[model samples]
Target: MATFAMTRERIFRELVERSNRSGNAIWLARMIASWRVGEGALPDYLGLSPEQFNNLRSHCFSDIALPHLAVSGKTVDYSRMLEKQDLETLLGDFRAPDVAETEWIIAILVAGCLGSDHLWQDLGLWSRSELSGLMSHNFPELAARNNKDMKWKKFLYKQLCEMEGLNLCRAPSCQVCQDYGLCFASEESTSVIDQVERNFNRDA
Candidate 1:
């Protein structure tokens, strides 16, 4: 397992390096890679049930595009939000620069533990700047080329589609789809994004 973990970390590091990320982007990617290796060991270390982790993971994704609505206060408490020390332990060698970064890491881990099986809905929790930082770290090459005016989610979806060779169209096929407006233009999505941004910034 240790050897496998090293190999995975090396692969992610090589990918990040090959992308030519620099400054905070490079640092963030390195930290994320290092932390990712400890994922399989998280349940044991945190004294968390793998089953319960999976259950929370389920609420992270949904075809309805309102996963956050599913996250009850009880669910948040049950998820056992990690403190700075717990994040440090799970992160191992990679040290987060501050509390915000640590919490960001925790959010990513929580999203992962809950399962990244669908298009990410929980990312709405992050503010514009926070999401921008993530784009820089996770998709440095794409992030560098993105037009500043582009919404982070749009940039992310575009990059993902390009990477996977997927042609995600919102014409005839997507127009009739339930999630059409969620990813594209819709009042609901705009409201949700605005609300989350306000909440995140206010808390910050």
Candidate 2:
């Protein structure tokens, strides 16, 4: 049994390494993360056996691909890829009213900023007020519905950092819960949400 497990682990690690080199590791990791492999059978969505899936989950690490994902490049405009519908779908799983909108907005903003080289210059607004105005124009109902008296820029920055942390710690075998380390009740995980909240309050 021990030998079998070891061999499986080796295979999983090799697969991950290959994926990292191919620059598809982020996509692969996201697929694994979405499947929630620890609790049930490996879904047919990935077309891998239960044992193989579990092995990947147990051995996979974000360090292999997260840095590349986080860094900005000229090839693709990541910000433009952050569609509002996608953000809504991603945050739909969250139950908390206060946190959900903020989280979604953050994800959208981070996805936009991360891939833009001249983010500041291109956007043409450094202060929170200017940024908030832009957000209000782009996502009109968001602020009015949330009823949160926070500066949009600071809130956006806080949320983006939290998203980055979440992206960094994401793995199939992560100690953190599926809430992406944002839920307070997840004792097994580190909550980047708390850090973002603290930063927001400080900036406020």
Candidate 3:
């Protein structure tokens, strides 16, 4: 497992260095590198279709070919279920007016939300701050609405709930919410390898 992880890490470094054509190169590299390698494929886990992955590949790693990666059965057909029509509409409505050709980033983000981790970790971003950078640049309107610095995942769901007229949050306001920590806790993440090391040590 360690050896396999090292090879994936190598792939990440190479991709990060070579990916320069778009603003999302490092994002893609982190996601591809940190992806699981069992029972699923790369595109399956990232919530991208085979063609979408290929398009992203052409944009980021045009001359490179990634190894066949396996993903878990959990993510099979995930994009269809997670990519809800209303959710996409919500994100689409807030698409940065100044940024051109940002639909793909929205697709990636919607798919990424299906994961069980913090939004940034699920998207294979290095940290919450990195995810914030993407959001601020690509969906500045939505980003600006998060005046409380709430966790991205929490903020997104809150937005969705409000849009759909669903009062999911129990608190009257975020500041007084019983689940305040869950929504506003500090989010610090590291490289994929470093994350594994931390988990390994914790379990040791």
Candidate 3 stretches greater than 4 Å from native: 1-9, 36-45, 67-83, 97-101, 189-195, 198-204
Clash pairs of candidate 3?
38-70, 38-71, 39-71, 40-71
After TM-score superposition, the amount by which residue 18's alpha carbon in candidate 1 deviates from its true location, in angstroms, is: 33
Which candidate leads in TM-score?
3
lDDT of 3 by residue, 44-111 (tens): 52566667667767767777876433454445354466536666898899888765436777777877
Q: For candidate 1, lDDT tens digit of each residue in 1-204?
A: 346446646845564555423333343344333333332112221222454333322322112111222222222242453442443343433333442333334444444333231212233221245445654554445457665435444544454456557777655664477765554442233332344356568999
**What lDDT does model 3 reach?**
0.70
lDDT of each: 0.39, 0.35, 0.70
Which one is best on lDDT?
3
Query: Per model, how many backbone clashes are there?
Result: 1, 1, 4
Model 1 has an lDDT value of 0.39
Q: Runs in model 2 with CA error above 4 Å? A: 1-85, 88-111, 115-124, 149-204
The TM-scores of all predictions, comma-separated, are 0.29, 0.23, 0.79
Residue-level error in angstroms, candidate 1, position 23: 8.5
Worst 10 residues of 3 by lDDT: 36-45
